[model samples]
Target: MTRHGEDIGRWLATQRRDWDRLNEEQQARLGKLGVKKAARARKAPAKAATASRQGKGGEAFQKGLEALTQYLARESRMPGRAAVQEMPDGDIRRVGVWLANQKQRRDRLHPDQLAALAHLGADWAR
Candidate 1:
């Protein structure tokens, strides 16, 4: 089911994952909906999933870095939010949109990712 265009399944999954952080009233409300807290014994698997996701994030960051570097090499400056770059492998990456997203999500970025962006002269990354 969906609410406000967001999938209830995904929302419930998040709620389960963060169940321990929820207030008593919130937990009770979810309990009424038949949602239970995440299993404590499952933490090891959760950590493994997080590691897998971080690995993928690292790969994506590398691709974004490649796109940005290629753009900079050709243009001598960062691309604007509307700029798109054709990667060497023929993949068209929206480098500008990626950069803009990075800036907006800078606070959530890994320290290494932020460092890479800062090294590339993205002031917002700092």
Candidate 2:
């Protein structure tokens, strides 16, 4: 079988057993064939897939997911909501760690001050 066919064969195997059994040459063949097949599959619906993939750029993804809607009077344009939603837990904790480190740099922070600054953010060697 071509590389793509080998990949399908490997996937069809029970518990990845077939993958473990393939020689390096066979694995390469499978990869080539699998990629060709994937290309063909993607070619048929490329536009929509491209459009969506373009949206998944991590921090760049606008994810305009709104927090709320509010009424605006004729005299006043609706102002953006002032209430900030809770930041992602991971980001909140990471920022805390970064701040702690920054405060401890001896040039930035004295050795005597490190222990007190430790929990504030970045770790500075005393």
Clashes of each: 0, 14
Q: How does residue 17 of candidate 1 score in lDDT?
A: 75
Who wins the lDDT comparison? 1
lDDT of 2 by residue, 20-100 (tens): 556777767866765222212233354344335545431221221111111122113322333232333422122222333
Off by over 4 Å in 2: 1-24, 28-39, 49-61, 64-126
lDDT of candidates 1 onward, in order: 0.83, 0.35
Model 1 Cα lDDT, one tens digit per residue, 12-97: 88799779889999999989988899875544564455445757776887899999999999999989999999997999999999
Q: Which candidate number would show the highest TM-score if scored against the true structure?
A: 1
